[model samples]
Target: MSEKRKLAFSKANYLIMIAGIIVLAIGFIIMTLDSEPYGFGFLGLTLGPIVVMLGFAIEFVAIFYKPKSKSDTE
Candidate 1:
């Protein structure tokens, strides 16, 4: 008999990935909204990139995240 296989990622991981994508989009939008020429101002040069990096970090965490199984909880 063949055994059923479980998914590699859980629902929570997918949600976290979606959140990371949204954050990345927001960061790009922020950079676009910068008033300075050629995106040289703080938002474009600093804050936007920071947010983007954070988004990437979130995505990394999501990819590696492992939820505790019921057996582990008990």
Candidate 2:
């Protein structure tokens, strides 16, 4: 008898990963929008990097996230 194969990540996890990627994109965009001649402004030097790091953190969470199963609640 053959059994169905399961995917590595759940739908929620994939959604979270997508969100993370979007956040990363937003951070990069913010950096590019900085008015400083060489991107030395606050957005380029601080906020943008912080947002990008947050995005990476979100991705890390998504990669390790596991939904609770009915059996696990017992």
lDDT of 1 by residue, 1-74 (tens): 59988788999999999999999999999999999999999999999999999999999999999888899977
Best by TM-score: 2
Which pairs of residues collide in model 1?
none
The local distance difference test score of model 1 is 0.95
What tens digits encode model 2's per-residue C-alpha lDDT throughout 1-74? 49988899999899999999999999999999999989999999999999999999999999999988899989
- Give the residue spans of candidate 1 off by over 4 A: 1-5
**TM-score computed on alpha carbons, candidate 2:** 0.92
- Against the hidden reference, what TM-scores do the models get? 0.89, 0.92
- Residue 72 lDDT in candidate 2: 100
Model 2 lDDT, residue 11, Cα: 92
Q: Any idea what lDDT model 2 has?
A: 0.95
In model 2, the runs with Cα more than 4 Å from the true position are none
